[model samples]
Target: MILWFTIVQIAVACAAGLFCLIAGLIGRRPSDYTVGSLLLVELLLLAQVVIGIVAPLTGNPPTGDLLEFWVYLIAAVLLPIGGIAWALLERGRWSTVVLGVVAISLAIMLWRMQVIWTVQVA
Candidate 1:
């Protein structure tokens, strides 16, 4: 994994988490901006998946166990999918709460990814 890109992803995830929390607190539904940010995060995650696969293919062994890597990747991909689904199911603050959950999940995955990267580097 690219260190810089991972850092960027972590930062973005934290910000999104904060925004989601605020939205939930204010009893506000997700706005276009919120959805757009989540989509952007997912896009970045997809890029990470590609890069992660390519790195291993090119003879760079993964930092974590293959199962761990796959788990993180799956969780990363599912966050946005879940967010979209929850947004559709609820119309207001509840939807934002769901988004907050997504953000938290994204942050956790990013941290796990970082740990994997560190293990790989060591």
Candidate 2:
């Protein structure tokens, strides 16, 4: 439930999304650079996952529905992985577009996760 970490994750997702979208617009297929950039995001998400898991155990559970927060975290971790898998198989600019869409979705998921974490306890 660290707010700054979630904010950084959102920023990274949006930046990655824009990068992939620009690559698609320029007629470039998914490449090492795209995957590498996504890999960074994936790594950050892994850290987030670890944090999410540990926080609850250490007395910092989300203020809202913990189940929903976990679901969002799972989805956030999977999106980049699925996108990379698709790109590897498709090997086209369309794959880049797909990745861009996934990255944008990841951003939304991060935002949702933050909201879930910060909901007022009642």
Candidate 3:
């Protein structure tokens, strides 16, 4: 994993989470802006996944438990995905709330991933 990119990802997730949380708490429904931001986050995760795969091939494998790191990566990608579906189904401020929570969780998961990557070398 690229440390710099991971840091940027965390920042993006946190910022997005705050945006969603505020929108949700203010009684606002989902909007294109929020949805677009969510999509951006998804795209970034996809990029991270690619980088993760390539990093190992290039001899930069994590020093930690690989399976655990993989699990975190999968969850980080999936949580927001599930939240997006739920938001679409629910169609209200609660949808944004779910997204907000997902974003926050994703950030934490990514941070853990960073730690795992750095601590456990191949």
- Candidate topping TM-score: 3
Number of clashing residue pairs in every model? Answer: 1, 0, 4
- Per-residue C-alpha lDDT of model 2 across residues 1-122, encoded as one tens digit per residue: 78899889889988989999999889999999888778888998999999998988998878888888888888888889999999999999999988888888888888888888887573
Model 1 residue 41 CA deviation (Å) reads: 1.0
The per-model lDDT (C-alpha) reads 0.79, 0.88, 0.89
What alpha-carbon RMSD in Å does predicted model 3 have with respect to the real structure?
1.2
lDDT winner among the candidates? 3
Q: Name the lDDT value of residue 115 in candidate 3.
A: 95
Q: Output the lDDT of residue 50, model 2.
A: 92
- Which residues of candidate 2, in runs, are more than 4 Å off? 120-122
Listed in order, each prediction's TM-score against the native is: 0.88, 0.94, 0.95
Clashing pairs in 2: none
Residues 13-83 of candidate 3 have per-residue lDDT tens digits of 99889999999999988888777677778889999999989999999888999899999998888887888
